[model samples]
Target: MPRAAIDVISVYVRKAQKQRSRLPSFRSLAALEAVVRHGNIVWAADELGVTPGAVSKQLGSLEEELEAPLFHDGHRLRPTPVAIELAQTLGVALHLLREGWDKATHGLDTGVVTITGNASLCMHWLVPRVLAMQAAAGGRAIRVTSLHTSDTWWQSTVDIAILRHRRVPVGWESQTIGTERLTLLGSPERARRAAERGIAALGGETFLAAETRHGDLDRWLAAAGVGADTERRDSVHFYVAIEAALEDMGMVVAPIALCHDLIAQKRLAAPFPACTIRGAGLAGAYNRAICSPRTAESLFRWMKREMRRCSILPAV
Candidate 1:
């Protein structure tokens, strides 16, 4: 608990650790861990179920083998430089082992998938595809969480993600799930109102913006070869933008595939041609490494299957 005590333990354990020519066995490592915890031969011996004399003899052997004095401060034990490096490395490796076991035993894949995504992707595209995935998988449950912040929710320890960024970070793997083609999705009543006034009437109404970079409005207008007037624009993130549109606040660009079912149900309708984003590929993202263990492979296969079924693009 005390800072000095932590430093002492850290030093000596590292020292005892470094004395070995090769990595220590679990028994030896455990002895080292015990010594670090107890801080002395007598205490380490009692905790490790070894004689005090034996503990002292082992420590001496370790130091001799490493040819490095592990304890610092003649009055206080110190770990040699080599010992410190070994301790930190072993600590991380041990933690990784524990984490691997935890992920394996927990039936995490049989349960929810904490997928990070914006509402527009969820509502228009993923929600339906997941439902289809659930139906085919038989008995697997899927959970979709909303990501509303400009900060990446996918950066969290989520199970999977439908990201919307162009670059995947180092050490991470990504897969192209599908592309977002922009088309106008209006609430049924809103479509009727616009129809009476003519399609150009949309130019006069305050449109909902998808606020984030590469959002629906930005992608759509860019795809359509148009730009915002800049003099007047209303912007909001996916969830807010969708809610506003549902409330008939204003029309927004949506992917045709995402809104097709709603249009059939007479809840939503597309007023424009579907087109790929201007100067961009279809707008959306997916990382391959984040799936839950059980579904990771299967869902990956399903995702590929679904994307192919819906798209003409070659699998990546």
Candidate 2:
């Protein structure tokens, strides 16, 4: 290209870069979001701790950036259709961004990080080991809330969660903790009897069921290529059923990881080899609207490291 043509191109490129750099900052977007949310400049200004004129100037600057009017400045300065739609989405995004910033900069260094999970997990796994995790975190507190196994437990304000989900909800993040597998546990005598009698002999024994995992026995039996014609006896939770099995109540279908300590101690024995069920696993989740990035990252890292050594998680 000739010198003059190259100079013109260079000048245009610099101007474009300058314009791109001038893209609306969070301040202007915040002002716009608040304005659209409140539906009035004065109210938005009050909410943002700024004067109405300042809010209007911010909107004006934003409008210049997009080269489009955002509001119909008629009798009430009504937001246009585009403005309303943009506000609806940007409000959520900006709220999440602000929460992440706050968490990154101002997490409770000495206070508790609340976590929630299913009752079985809290009892059998996390509760026992959380104190060590807390100590590792330099005395930051760890508070756990136990939810019913069937509860849609992820839509909460907790910093972390350990639960099973078919699909995560919108505005949330998740990580796979472990893939669930089932084993039939019983007392020493019962296990030997079942093993000798081809697991079908235990059909008449009391089936200590986990209320949380309805149909778990059926699933386990089917996976082991056995028919499900067993007696129905239910326990409140997995731990309860495991305890019952330890005391020779009945054969219970349980997660292998949860039954490890008992089996190792000879408190419970596997009547049949463990079978990986088709579709069951646990995950950790947090609401993006509430959880800070720093909190989420830290908790995920802590759980990943802890679960690998403690539970039957899939290899990373």
Candidate 3:
């Protein structure tokens, strides 16, 4: 358990005792926490192994005891400020208690550290270096989960997240992992033609675009000072776009981090290296309330080292 969590719990207990007010039952508090965390009574009830009615009753009991409403009545429950704060504290405390119980029953070092990130990044970057990451973790088991680009950090059950945001979100600790440098990539033969004839050589070729990166092609084109009109094909993901590019379908603008290995293997080529556009800054995020800072830092450092190894240009 973190000392901060212990202190917060102790303070809560002391305040309840001083006021001579009974602390809410553990079940009621758990219900409140789950409901607020999930933002859906049915989901919370499912998590707690109870019916929605039961969860509602628990929430009512808690509200009655405290003489205050915790959630707004709407299609979706919106937690009040107090509810959010209490739920956050309870979340940390409960997670620590669960960890303590797990350690006592299963023994220490039994936990698997889960790292989640963009699916393309996991496939092209992290998956290849997972063994090195594990070794850097001092032999601790590591699990990597790929998340869709639209998935939020709160929706994941990961120990660490490779987030696109440079700023740390509230309630989480984070470190800058890398900057994404979007580069124009294509098949070797197409790249050779472009290198010899400049950007005009690919004017007739299709532009493979990823739906997730809607404006990246235009951005890269503007950065590269190219004004030629070209046909385009859109894919749902960067990986698909890259695959299309590899098959000589079209040129795709992608993060170098995702295509660096292919480039190194001579499977793909960057025709205009100087035209790389700076993209989102990546961060490694973790809940300090539950994750050990030292462990998170170690993993973050390894991630940084690996990214640096694959990067073809300096982050600007």
The most accurate candidate by TM-score is 3
lDDT, candidate 2, 101-155, per-residue tens: 8876666443677778777677777787678767655667888888876676655
The residue ranges of model 2 lying beyond 4 angstroms of the native Cα positions read 1-104, 108-110, 135-139, 149-157, 166-171, 274-279, 305-316
Model 2 / residue 305 / CA error / Å: 4.5
lDDT of 3: 0.80
Better of 1 and 3 by lDDT: 3
Task: Give the alpha carbon lDDT tens digit for every residue of 1-316 in model 3.
Answer: 5555466457666767876988889999999889988989999999999999999999998777656688877766898766777788889779999999887654523467788887788888878878888888777788888887666655455678887775455778887989888888889898888888887555666789988778889888877777647789988977788888989988999888778888887878888888888888899998665556667888888889878777773332
Against the unseen true structure, what C-alpha lDDT does each candidate score? 0.58, 0.72, 0.80
TM-score, prediction 1:
0.52
Worst 10 residues of 1 by lDDT: 278-287
Candidate 2 overall lDDT versus native: 0.72
C-alpha lDDT of residue 107 in model 3: 50
lDDT (C-alpha) at residue 247 in model 3: 96
Candidate 1 residue lDDT tens string, 1-316: 3454466456656766775345335545455545654566578788778897776566666656555665675867556555555445545556788799887765455565655566765766577777776764454767767677565665676666656555655544556665544566678778777667765455575666655644556556555555565222456565566567777777766554445555666666555543444222332344445554445556656766665454332121
